[model samples]
Target: MAPTIHCVRHAQGVHNLCTANHVIPDPLLTDLGHEQCAKLREVFPYHDKIDLVTASPLRRTIYTALESFEPVFQAHPEFKLIALPDLQETSDVPCDTGSEPQALQQEFAGKNVDLDMVHEGWNSKTGRYAPINSALRERARAARRWLKARPEKEIVMVTHGGFLHYFTEDWEDHSQYQGTGWSNTEFRSYTFSDEDHNADLEGHAVDGDNATLVETAESRQRRGKVGPTPDRAQQKTLYQLGTQSWNQQLSTEEQDSAKVPEGEEVNGVRV
Candidate 1:
């Protein structure tokens, strides 16, 4: 059977509590973020079905996975929980920086997660250059290949919001309502294909391409209203969750100018 991937974005990190544009390297979850993770544990419907749990090496993501899925881990020792450095967020921004693997093992302490598989400097950032965008795209594709190779029928990954966009490559502005990208602690399930993964590896640019996602029937049922555009209230909520706030020092005109066009997307995948 084809594997089903449950992609989850970490709950609000310490950086999220700030107004905007301020960067804090590899911060942990805020109190509210922890609360969100706890709520996720209560509401998540896939605990029994998930056979594998993977998390980005980032602190926030690791915490989210531990808080939300530790029960599943305890209940099913046969299920594996592995940390993947390649799954880190797709930005060179300070907030996206990750800690070393050894530090992460010490941080988790008695947790059941496996930190042995991580490579050295797996958390290092590529410099802020024009080509880094393409490199991140390829990294996303490579990570997809890695995940698909796993033998588990159902897998769960706790990662960052920015990278989840590239992971799905559904860069549509319409994707917000389509369950393409994610909100805090949100989980969306997708089915992967070797053919689609190969297309991305064989020179298809994630920026221009619409990578078709095969969402599970359960995923579709759980998704919000389906539409070309989100309603006004939904739009406000999305703007708050999906992008950085404009600098308060800037004039309204400057902020408007900085905003992407209403019908267009800013990040690869987001409204």
Candidate 2:
């Protein structure tokens, strides 16, 4: 069976404070952020069952994973926090980009966090890590494939809110003009969909492999009663709108400076 994925958006960071803080390069978690992690640590029920813990290389995400899953690490010393470069935030803003591997290693020295998967140019907003729509889609696909191939039965991932939408391929509540609806430290559980259907919405297929993720019933129950679920047609429309929004944002950024606009209202909070 494929591993059950617990996707968590990083807790509040310094950049989440105000628009001005968005320029802080690789900002750390706020005091509330740490408290949120503590709360998650208390409520998270799979500490003993978790076989792997992964997170984006960004400071906030790394800290979130370490703090929120401290019990898991304590119980299983063999598992180190895997830093996945492909799980980095979708944007190239200063707050979203990660620090150099050396700096991260020095900061997290004794924390049992592994930076081996983070490449030299992982933080750069060029090439595969570009903020454009196509690059992000491909990265999301690769990340899904990697997770599906893992041997672990239960896994945890701490990543940004914007990228979470892409990773899950569910844009039900996504918005291009504003930030994501995912709350700070909020977590959703998912299981890989069956591979009977080989092609994705984009017609991408790999040896009849299906990388779609289906949210577990427990996760939905945690969210309480919500509105009616959108149909397949609605989902595809939302996905296309999300892709177009990303491309439009990329074009605007290319014409202007790499920095966000003065108001600093990004697609996702602090992204």
Candidate 3:
């Protein structure tokens, strides 16, 4: 079966060169960002299986998708890059509030979408549609099921960090959600996964690390970790659980390290 879509965020861009009200920043990836993409390719050595690539239309996301995957896709028969407007960053609020008018608002505006807490106010008091995100998620869930229907393929989507963290469901908050994006050349491949694969990982905290978590449908419905798992900060990195390419390259160590089998998938998460 194919993995759910990869859903990656774009590389870093100039945060302060310029900013303006209603203006989006058009920064490119930085040197450090390039290094990070290289690290991503090395860590996920089996990147050629991606059947398709998609991205938000923003320059950072488009450039990131092209720079990171072109090497792997050169030999791919069905690979092509597409765009999804739904994956764009949260709309920038206007500059009507004169909080910081030292200069043009353009310089500092890009920073707003960097990395903030996930949108929790689904039903804000304003009764107006709160962008504490919802529709984006509904669309992604639909997208995930649609992709999984295809067999033997992987999908890559490069977008902004906000969509990656707050909207993409399979991640289970496993994403580092660090303030910065990958270096211009660096990229990471996230397995589009179902909740069942992680049933064994829940309530299983590694040291003070409350952030790195997994979930299954039944348990997630019953004992949702209300906000942070309410623990001390411990160190942990994102780790893969499974993939077709991974199975082929399964060293004894890797076979042993995988958290679950290939057939397992959370039906509740399946549309």
Candidate 4:
């Protein structure tokens, strides 16, 4: 049986404060971010059930996985959080890009986090890591395949907002203007679709099919609301916009800020 995956967006990072902070290379979580993780740790219900935890190699995500699931790590001394490069954000901006492995190792020396999968050039935006639509799609597929092959019965993946849409292949509420609808540290449970089970993992059969994550009914109930399903055109548009170059997207965001009223705010940040 496929693992029950819980997808979580990392808590508030410095870049989440405002567009200017996006220049802060691989910024850490803000104080509020840590506080959010603490709340998640308290509220998260599957602490004992999770067999493994994984996160994007970015510091904010690593910290989120460790802090939010600290109980799981503490209970199982044999497990270490696996940092997967494929789980990194879709954008190539400094804030989204990761740091060197050595620097991360130094910073998280004593932490129960593994960086073996985060190889050199993993942070580079070139090749498979590029923010192009094709690359992002392939990366998301590879991540799903990897998760399906894991032996764990349950898993947690702490990742970024923009990339979550791709990873789950769910764009029902995705907004090109606002990015993902997922709030910081918010998570939803999912399981591999039946199509995923039927497709041949070793061959290219899964490539043509939409072998993706299916949000559990319980997760939907937990969310308390479900928007209308997006049409194909809308999904395509959202995916294209979401996968655009981060700098280009940031420029668009800056241009849009001019339209905001003086006292109004965008993304909880005063514009």
TM-score of each: 0.73, 0.87, 0.47, 0.84
Could you give candidate 1's per-residue lDDT for residues 72-135 as a string of tens digits? 8889876557888778876555666787778887887777778886767666664321114456
Q: Supply the global lDDT for candidate 2.
A: 0.80
List residue ranges in candidate 1 displaced over 4 A.
Answer: 19-22, 78-80, 127-131, 173-181, 193-198, 201-213, 227-271
Give per-residue CA lDDT, model 3, range 82-156, as digits (tens): 544445553332210112222213333432122121133311212222232334334344344444555646677
Q: In model 4, what lDDT does residue 214 have?
A: 77
lDDT by residue (105-176, candidate 2, tens digit) is 899998879999987889997889888766777788789889999999999999988888888877776752
Q: How would you order the candidates by lDDT, starting with the best?
A: 2, 4, 1, 3
Q: Write the per-residue lDDT of candidate 4 for residues 1-271, one digit (tens) a residue.
A: 9899999999888887776676789999998889989999999999999999999999999999999999999999889999999999877668888999999999999899999999999999779988766677778888988998899999999998878887887765665334666888989999887743333312234545455677888887788856434534456665555545233334324534534223323444222
Model 1 residue 181 lDDT score: 49
Q: Which candidate is the best by lDDT?
A: 2
Candidate 4's C-alpha runs over 4 A off are 196-210, 226-271
**C-alpha RMSD between model 3 and the true structure:** 17.4
> Ten-residue segment with the worst summed lDDT in candidate 3?
262-271
Lowest summed lDDT window (length 10), candidate 1:
243-252
**Count of backbone clashes, every candidate in sequence:** 0, 0, 17, 0
